[model samples]
Structures are given as C-alpha cells and as structure tokens.
Target: MTEKLNRFGMGASFVPAETLNEIDLGPLKQLVGEWESVVLTQTDEKGVSKPLASGWNVISVPGVPKFTFEVIPYKENLKFSTVAVHAGNRGPVLNGTQFDQEIFGLFYEQQIVSMCDTDFCNGRGFGKDTVIHAETGLLLYVSNINGGYNIARLGTIPHGNAILALGKSAQANNPGTDFFDVISALGVNLDGSIPAMLGYNDQISGIPQFAEFQQVHPNTFLKSTLDTIIGSGSVTDMTVLSMSTSHPDATGGILNIPFIQSNVTATSMDATFWIENISGGSEPEILQYSQTINLVFPSTGTVTPIIWPHITISTLKRMQPQPETNEPLTLSAQAQSNTPGVPQL
Candidate 1:
C-alpha cells in the first residue's frame, strides 16, 4: 500500500485551490493534484538521448510532486496562477549558485505556468486586449494568437511516469546583436550611440530595426517537428502553437553571440491539458516538441541556421483522479502578450 501511495503523490490534497482573488482555475482545476514526475532524457554527445543524471539513482531526483493553483493579480480582466514542482529545488548544473533557483525554477523542464481565460477559449490569448467573443457559456476556436503573456506545456506520461516540457518562446522577432550589420544595412538607427544586443529591450525602441521586428511579428511564435515518440507513450494529443522569428534567437542557445541577451527565434510551446481518462488505468502519453529560432553565427566567416530546439519527452500515470469537485483545466497556444518584453506579473 505504501508503494501504491508513492506512485500517487499526496501533496495536492493538502493545498487549497478554492479561489485566488475571486478567480477560478476554470479548466485547469484538475492539475491541483500530486504527480510522479521524472526527467527521463537529455541531449547526449551523439545528439542522442540519455537519462538526465544517469550517474544517480531515480530516488534522488524526487518522484512525487504536488502542484498548487496559485495566482497573481496583474491588471484588470487579467488574473493568473502558478503551478510547478521542486518546491525550492535547483538544477544540478547551477553549481549551488542561485541563478537556476527560485523563479528560475519556472523555466525548468518541469516548472511554472499560468492559466487565464484565453486557455479555455482555444489557445487564443485574452489579456487586457483582444475581444474573445464567448457566448454566455460557449467558446470559439480561432487561428490567430497574440499576447505578450503566453504559455507552452508538454504533458506526457511515459512508462506510467509524467514529464513536463517547456518550449522557450519569442514574443516577437526580437532582433539582438547578430543583426547589427543587418540593422546597419537597413540604414536605420535612432543614433550611433546604441550598441548591439543579444535580446530585446523595450526601452530601446528608438532604433528602426528593433521597432520593425516587433511590428513584423507582433505575437508569440512557434513551430513544431512532431515526428514520433519524443520520449515514450502514445502521444494521445499534441499541438504546436504560434511562431515568430527573433532576429537571431529567442532561446539563449547561441551563447557565442556578440552580446549576452539571446538570439532571434521561432519558439515552440505546449498548450493545455485535462485528464484524458480516469478509469484508474496507466497508459503512457508520448511527448516530443521543439521550436525554431533562426541562428546565425560566424561559421568559417559565413553564417548558417542551427537546429536550435527546446524539446522534452516523458510518460506518466494517474496516481490520483481529479477531485470530484475539481474542474478540468484547458489550454491553447493561440496568442501572445501584446506587451512584449514582459512576462512577469
């Protein structure tokens, strides 16, 4: 019986998700439970996959995780909550420094995310702006997604264990340093005082190249190459939503850039989830996904596109069912936060 209890985490039942500033969790309500999470694989030397810390046993990584439906009141008509694992845990690579700690945990493979009205309305973002034409209690699915605020989640259960993947994003074509020459080629700059960048800075919009990039792709961008099993499971359902090109990269994968920001990118993100079944069965869900952000670097004096992708895969089991009174959560990657360069609320 203890073994069975271990399979199903016990943290969820203890947390209270009844309300946050009078906001309801909506479709995401089911996530208020415990789960057995595992970091199954990481990029290997040959570009293959291997266990995250093969050197260590699975017991050290922490299995059972409980998620709390918490939120922050940002602005009018925009309220949100956070859900993540590791309760103050840090990654192995942090070297004990606080860089990959606290808020940084949200960006981890299994980290934080928010749920608002838009996720329920079919991936279409509904923040301070955007008119979501919902009829009384009806929802319409649209193709256009925009909002500086966005979320991508990969939920999969491999071998009866769950894994969550986060697809780094580019709110818009935030050109950074690599494009200085390109910016110069456009013959546009507020003044010659500005320097090259690795990521976007809203205050520096005086530059033509910077302003134009945002105007060109004014939304969260994403692209997906869903082949087969990213890790394991049947891949019951998966969706890659929204994509925009950063000048060089959205993910900081290109570390060798001139500046310390990040490269332009076409990010990929996972959308939403609800318990697929509750018959007390253990079936795996395949999870594999990534996004594109055109990477340009001095490759032998020339430049080329690197397959820079943020991907994850895993399997999970339903250790616990959604609270009988708990509502299921829904998510869709149909929008980007209009206020670029700001995801903190």
Candidate 2:
C-alpha cells in the first residue's frame, strides 16, 4: 500500500538520493486529481511605504475544475510589434505583428504546468508557466504576461490587460492613492481600460464593467475557479521563487521594453492541507488543501516587478481508475467506463 503524506511547505531541506541524477516527486504524485478552492485572498506589502489596505478579495468556481497541472510540452513563443511606414513617415505607422514561437526553442519534454484560464487570466491578460527545478526541489514557474505580472498571476490581472501602459506607467501605491492604482485598474470598463476598481464604481455603476471580488453581478460573488496540487511533507519543504526573463512578448512590446536583457526569477508556493476525522471512522476520511501562489514577472527596463499572490482552497479526493482489462468486457461491464488516468501499459 502507498503511504499517505500528511503535509509539505517551505523550510524543508533536500536529502539527495543514492542515484546522482534521479529526483523524487514527493507528495506531488497525489496531486494528480481534481480540486476546488472555497476561499482565497491576494495581498501585498505596500503598507510599509504607504497606507495599509486590503488586496484582491476573490474566489474561484467549483465542480468544473478551473486550475489544472499535467505532464505537458514545455515551450515559449516570442512576439514583436512591427510597423509599416507611409511614403515619407519617419515614425513607423501600422503594418502587422510578428511572432517567434519558442524563441528560446526547447525540445518537447514533460514539465509541471499551470495556467489561469477560468474567469480571470485570459489573453493580453493571460497567465501560464512551466516550472523547472534542481535536484533539491527548488522551482521557478516562469511566465511573462503580454508580458507578465509576477505576484498576481494566479489571482487577478495586476495591471489589467493594458500591457502597453504597464511597461510605461509607474507602479501604484496605497489606499486609492496615486502610488498604487488597484482600484482604477480593476475599475476598467468591460473594454479593459480603467480608473481602476475604485474609480469604476464612482464613474460608472450598475454596469458589467464595474465589478469586484465581493460582487460579480447584482448579488453574486464572482469566484475564480481552481483545481490544483499541494506538496506533501512539512511546511518547511516549500518556498517561493520570484523571477524574470526577457523576450519581445514578455512586455507586450511596450515602449522601449528591454528588447534584450537578463532575467531574474522569484517564486514560492504557500500551502496547507488538513485531514478530517470522524468519531469512529477509518483513519481520517477526508483531506483538503489551501495554497497561495507567489509568481513574479521579469522586469522591464523601466517598469518594476509585477507580483501575483494567487490563492486557492480545494477539497481532495482520489479517483483511481480500474485496472486495464485485456479480455473484452461484457455488455453490462462496458456501460460504465473507468475514470481518466488509468494505467494502460
């Protein structure tokens, strides 16, 4: 029987295996299933420089898994904005956009992958990453938005979908001040532009464009769905890595974005798992987990790092597929198919 791991997080040390090159996946093996995040919050440390205030108060959808990870092909594409000049134009006019898929070309290989594709994190504002780690379990989930916003990648779009403005604009400060524009950024009209979330309510009310974590509609709380895996071991086993990289697409080809530069990385995972026990049941029957993701972006020549503190709460359940059958199934047996991920070989 497989031994169950109870917990895992930052501060744990790595013990090298006898095999020099082999790596153990740890509790991550049990993470290969569906889950749901019941509650979540994404915040930052802006108070030290300004006023103390709350951050994105959002949640995810349930049942229909919103977050997923798998053995996926690892690759990245690079895009550059091109322009067509008129007869005598010194400044370039419009032509079309050019893209280089896998600019840092990579061979097809399996990697732990995660992406924000539910209610939030979609195009121009999408978030996705392929993590790499040394033998010690240190990992970095690298990705650039149109470029990227590191901290909020898993929560809400930090600067919204305004990639052009992100690289050129300054970071916002505290509590509705000019320092940080959280409100105005979230307030953007459905069109994706904004005075931020705060200004959205003041300028336009009752419109779909004006929304927040508390209210997606008249009475509904717009929840962001999540299906994720948590590490199993001790709280000290896991940590965050904040990183950055350079590619034409990383900064959405924003003004003077470092067309070529060095990349730094920042990343870490905040997680908690619990087991519920009944008065007289079979060794604690239920397991659940809550995790917060800290993914930061590569900095542009002028822009500061974008941080995304993505969070999720999900219930855990094992869905073991029946053993593959060599013999043909009877009519009744064929009716109920086995769940996905069954061993076929």
Candidate 3:
C-alpha cells in the first residue's frame, strides 16, 4: 500500500503504488499526436505596413515519447506606394505608377529543438534563424556551419515528398496580394531614356536588351525542413529570445513591425523592426498599429489541457511626415488589441 496525500491536506489516505502508476494517460497521449499549422507574415517597405502571423505545431513520436515543434509562415499580400524624386529638384509627388512591391515574405518551414539535461530533465531550445524570400522564391537555408547552431537537423526526411507538398500548397493557397504576380512579372519599368542610358538595350547599341530576366517564380523555391524531439517537461519551461524580420530591402524608408512571442512565462512579448532608407535624401519613419486575437486548442481525451494560453498580438508601423509641423521627420506610434484563450497548459 502507498500513502496518498489529501487534496486539502486534511484527510489521511493510502493507495497502492501500482494503482497510482496505472492512471490512464489516454487524454495526454491523444494530445501528443502530430500537428501542422501555417503562419502569415507581411511587411510593407513602401509606406503602408501590415502584420505577420506565425503558426506553431507540436508532434509526438513513439520511441522518444517527446514533443517536437514546427513553424510555417504565410505572407500577407501588401500593395502601397510612395513618391520619389526621379530627377533633380523635383517636388514630392505621389507616384501611383510604381508597381506594387512586398518588402518581406512568408517564412520557411523551420525546425525547433528542445535542449534537455539527461534527456528529460531541464534544458533550453531555440529555433532556426533562416528565412525564405517570398518574391524570388529563394530558400536561404542556414545550418550549424555559419557560426550559428540555433537550428540543426537530428535526422533526415525524404526531400521529394516535402518539396511536392510545399509546392502544391503554396500554389493552391495563392496567399499573396492580387497584384503580386503582376508586379513580379513586370519588374521596375522606368520611362524616358533612363532604361536605354543604363545600357539595357541590345549589343549593337552597347545597351542591354530586356531578354528573359529569368525572374525567380514564387513557387519553385524550396526551404529545408527539420524536426527535433525533446522531453515533455521541456515544453512547460520555454523562453523567447527575440523575434525579428529577415533581409529587408533598402528601397523603402524606415519600417517598424510588431511580433508576439508565445509560451513565455512573462506576460509581455517585445519586438523591434529595423529599416534602412537607401532611396537617398530623406530618412524613413515608423508607425505602429496593433491587434490581438483569442486562440483555442482542440480538446483531447477526457480531460484536455490548453496548450497556448497567450493572445495573438499583431502590429503595423510605417514612415510618415509630421502632420502638425509639416516637416520631414519620422514618427512612431503603437496600438494594441487583445484576445483571450483557454487556460489549461
């Protein structure tokens, strides 16, 4: 017989050790199955900014009996424009002719690992630091070789299957702006003699010809996918280092984007976005718009536990001039919206 502690610490009780160990784990076991989610990220370097949604999932394996984390990103289609001084002394005018451009794209399928001590004790884990470009459809997969071990592969999965799945979904979903395909098809089209002067004509004129630009389509690119399994206890104790944007173009002015970090013991998640204005002359500004959403996880077994308890935070920031002063300046503002979620896990 085994002694059982009273819930209120008032009654004396005894129970068999074998009975205690025989407790049904069906509920927890069902909750540990494989899962897949998608996240959407959008950044407007032009002027108008949008929000990025990140998706997370956890899966369980038979042998290890641990949890593995996977993240997938979807890109928000953004369309906005800003004026630029083509020639010298030109006044600041709205250039509606500028083709729609997207500053950032959907994130790649990244593998997250759980670091553990003694394979099940206490440890920490981090996600891979690589990002996939939405426009060029290029996958810049970075491994442990480049002075960074944030993301590593514990095993290998079939490449053909993953590629096929990624391609089919990316094409079927078409999660980009309406004009994304249009602008991508027709690159920066400049008027006047500029195109010719830049030697963009045929060989006879010493100018370059617009042969097939060999534009990289959005669907052909493929990113690496990896998975890691860690002990169950490791999931409860998680920390977020910092959330950031990937390689941003210099064409747009200053940009500020807001992101949320989940599973954080702390109540707040902080994020910062950096932008460099290579458009020349003036600097850019950042404005922030925020919103929140409630999330609910599906119930599992008899007594299902809520895994994600935090609210989804979204923000959008851009560069603009001071309304009152009418001076060339940068302004940053923040807005927040909140959503509730289940409080089990």
Candidate 4:
C-alpha cells in the first residue's frame, strides 16, 4: 500500500502499489501528443505569394554586412512521450508537517527545418528545408511545497547549451495581453531592419528581397491563427504556462559550453506557451508558443558586447494522442530503492 499525503497533513489515502497507472498529469495532460506546425499562406494584390510559416526565428550573426540579421521561416515537429507518473519527492518535516511532493514528467523532442530556398536570405542559407534546430527536453509537473503548482522545463540544445526554467501555470478563458505585447513590441519586421529594441545605434541593413520576410513579427504568424479562432468563437478552453531562466520564485538559468560562451553566450531565456481547445476546427487542440533567448556577442577591436534577442514562435496542431502502451510501468524498483549519499557500488 502507498500512503498519499495531502498538503494539509490532515489525512492519508492508501492505494495499492500496483495501481501506478492511475496518475494525475495536472495541466500538462494537454501536451501529450505529436504536434506539427500549421503553415499558412497569403497572397497580395500583386500576386506575390508569401508563406506565413508556423515557425519563425530572428537572430543576429556576422557576415559581409558587418552585423547580419536573418529572419528564418521554418517548420517544426514536436513530439512528447510520457516518461513517468507519480515520481515522488521526499520532503522535509518542519516541526510536525510533511511536505512531500510528486511529479508527472513528459519527455519531448523538437526538430525544426528551414523553409527557405537558396539565395533567399543572403547566402547564409540553411539549404532548402534543411534541419536548423533540434532539442530534447523534459517538462515536469510538480506540486509546490507552499501551495499551488509549478512547471519546470529541462532542455538540452545541440548548440552546446542547456537550460532549466521554472514558473507557474494557469488555465484561463483567454490569453492575457502580456503574451502578445512582448513579442509585438520586439519583433523584427521584414523591411530588413532590426527592431528599435535591439539598440543598435548605426543603421543596420540586409532586408531580404522577399516581402514575406519584410512585414511581420515572428509571433504575428501565431496571432493570425489565434485571431481567426477567437473571432470564430471556437475557443472552449485556454491554458497558459510562462517560464523563464530568471523566475523570481525559482533558481533557474542556462549553461553553455566553453566555445559558445566565448562567442555567442546565451545569457537568459523566456518562453510562454498557450494551449487552446477549439470546439470545431481542423484540429481539436492547438498549441502556440513564443520563446526569446538573449545572446551576447563578444566585442572585437572596437565593438562592445552586443545583446541580441533570438526569438522563435509557432502555432502547432496536435496530430496524434499520447503513445498507448498495454504494459504497466515498472515503478517498484525506483520507489523502494534507497542508496546512501556516498554510493558504495
């Protein structure tokens, strides 16, 4: 029998140890599936076609243009698999109360590919539809010792950087303005000029020849979809999870390898995810996320270290439900094992 204690220390509920499948995933249950970006297209009166991709990335790099800025349109596939349920955390007993906690975690893999053709955005081409970014991470659903709940992300990037960010979760009727404002205020337009927020005193140039890359914020792709859904009165439910490397209530940050740290050091990261349930749409569940990473480029002979924002945003539709398995989880070994602080084996 396993005794489940509540935050109040009032009573305990006992259940058979074999019933490990009966788990509460909290709000993270909405993310349990495979998702693919919802790519949209728009054509102007002049008959020029623009691909409003589901994913967009804006970053500053070095090239023939001194400080070269690239706006990348991309497609992404993100898959989440259930890793564990009811992962326990033994808490301390303060005075007379036990502050035990449990976690439900999901492991995710994200792959992003460029949607650009050759010579479209300078010769800094990632090739036609080539893989641009890949990441593996874990999303944890945890119960805070004090009261409510916490959501934490453990992500490993192939760019020699690792991140751990923590924050609270909310289920709301509509997403707050903060989610839209931050991105709109800082997003780079397609005119080939960086946002004023970038704080570059000199005139920065290198606008792509295509109008598709010239007139929208990275998050505008997501907002367009959201606007259509909201206008249609189809949003039945909304869930928002916002996390950051500098969360006030938690200790979280990013770590970079020596090579990356010496050049483009990732200083901080902030991301927000909005999941909505549409009553009648092509897909029942839609996931939208906006992530911004701050990077510092080391100074050369005359230039000072420049802090640039790398932003990625996407709107994804759940393509499939979580993986189904008939075999029960092997929880006993982990639940009953206790090795000393200093391991002998």
Return the TM-score for each candidate structure: 0.26, 0.24, 0.16, 0.75
Better candidate number, 1 or 4, judged by lDDT: 4
Angstrom error of the Cα, residue 77, model 2: value is: 28
Candidate 1 per-residue lDDT over residues 162-226, each given as its tens digit: 22222323221312111111111111123323224322222222332221122122111111111
Residues 202-300, candidate 4: write the lDDT tens digits: 322334434554323566656666765455556677898888888655688999989877766787888988888776555577899988887776333
Error of 2 at 338 (Å): 31
Single out the weakest 10-residue window by summed lDDT for candidate 4.
336-345
Taking the tens digit of each residue's C-alpha lDDT, what string does model 3 give over 1-345? 112334443332322223433332211111111122222224466766553332221111111122212112222221121111011112233575432211111112222221111222121122122221111111111211222312111111111111100000001121111211111111112221122223222222222121111122211111100001111111112111122121132111112122212221112112211111111212121111111111222222212222222211111123232223323212111111120111111
Give the 10-residue window scoring lowest on summed lDDT in candidate 2.
Answer: 80-89
- Clashes (backbone N, CA, C under 3 Å), per candidate, total 45, 60, 12, 3
| Distance from true location, Cα of 154 in model 1, Å | 15
Residue 284 of model 4 has an lDDT of 70
Model 2 lDDT, residue 75, Cα: 19
Q: Which TM-score value belongs to model 4?
A: 0.75
Q: Which prediction has the highest lDDT against the true structure?
A: 4
TM-score-based ranking: 4, 1, 2, 3
In angstroms, give how far residue 171 of model 2 lies from its true place. Answer: 43
Candidate 2 has what TM-score?
0.24
